[model samples]
Target: MTGAATGLGLGIAERFVADGCVEVHGLDITPTPDRVVPGLQHRTVDVGDAQEVDDCVEAILTAAGRIDILVCNAAIMQDRHEVLQTPDELVERVLRVNFGGVFNLCRAVGRAMKDAGSGRVVTVSSQVAETPWPGMAVYAASKAAVTTFTRAFALEMAPYGVYVNTILPGTMDTNQMRDSFAGLGRMTGADPESLIAAKRTSMPLGRMGTPQDAANLASWLASDQASFSIGGVFDLTGGELWSRS
Candidate 1:
């Protein structure tokens, strides 16, 4: 699991450990994660760095012998900035983590799964990839790119028995979401919290999704039950996507 330190990554890792995954390895950029489950082994890994990702995968294989399931959830969302105001460096950084991380890990782990002739890869993408948020063009594009690439990767690995699928989660109530939407306060002339609350209440479900909700679906996708499904983009947006403009 990538981004296993916090937010959805942490939540999913916890769920996997609690579900009795033998020797779950959680990878994060942070040296110390917010929470450490007893069974999940936390490792400091910058998923954006291809060399680092490769080394970490090798190490995990050495220790665990085989990685049956790979989860790609590491991503970054920046403060909303219109394309005219965005810096080139910011675009590159976001693409590096949001897209490149998935590419690198999938290539590395997918190779292993192909050789083993059986494995599951579940990726966390965003609904914004399809909806295209106004000021988050790069983030949305990165997500779109990954979702497409993961689908292609899935096809290539299918004959080898490696199933790959993506999760398109809607407005998740996380610290990252709050921070990224802070700029919405400016556009709405309301405080960020108020804007977020209003958005949540306007959702068809009357609430935003949570990390635990994502974990539940991701867990299901990682199981043998989902083996028949590959290259699928599962939506967990709490009915928000259809309701949104």
Candidate 2:
């Protein structure tokens, strides 16, 4: 998994360990937690860099001898801003870290999976992919690309008995989400807590989703329980994306 140091990545990595993944590697741009699981390995890596991703994957394969499961969960999202006002550099950075990172990781690790003749790849997308949000055009677009990429790749991998799927998570209560809303507050001149409260009010479930909520699906998809599942975009966004009758 990429970006497994915190937020959804950390939660998913923890779940993977609990679900009996003997050896789980957590890779990210920053140092991972020292609170180590005996079977878990931590590596600092920038998934946006192709060389870094390749080296990391190679190192893991050398140590583990095989790659069986891959979760492309690395992404970055800036506060919602109008497209015209959005800087080219910021847009490029988001796209690079979000979409480009997934591309490089998938290319490097995907080859291993294909060579091994089977693997499960779960890409972390966003509820925004289907339920577009104003001012978050870039993030939604990138996740839309992720979903499309998963579909196309799933078809290709199906012949090799490999499966690729996407997990669409809603607004989750994580440090990342807090930071995101805080950024939005700065951008919009509103109190961060107020914006978050408004978001909670909008959710039919009356609360934001959790990392574990998404991790449950990730665990299922990564296991043999979902062997027959492929090319699916599983949403864990509560009822936020649904229209009320």
Can you tell me which runs of candidate 1 are displaced by over 4 Å? 186-189
Candidate 2: tens digits of C-alpha lDDT, residues 202-222: 888888888788788899999
Regions more than 4 Å wrong, model 2 = 34-38
Give each model's whole-structure lDDT.
0.88, 0.86
Cα RMSD (angstroms) for every candidate in the order listed: 1.2, 1.7
Q: Provide TM-scores for the models.
A: 0.97, 0.94
Model 2 residue 15 CA deviation (Å) reads 0.9
On TM-score, the candidate that comes out on top is: 1
Residue 226, candidate 1: C-alpha displacement in angstroms: 0.9
lDDT of 2: 0.86
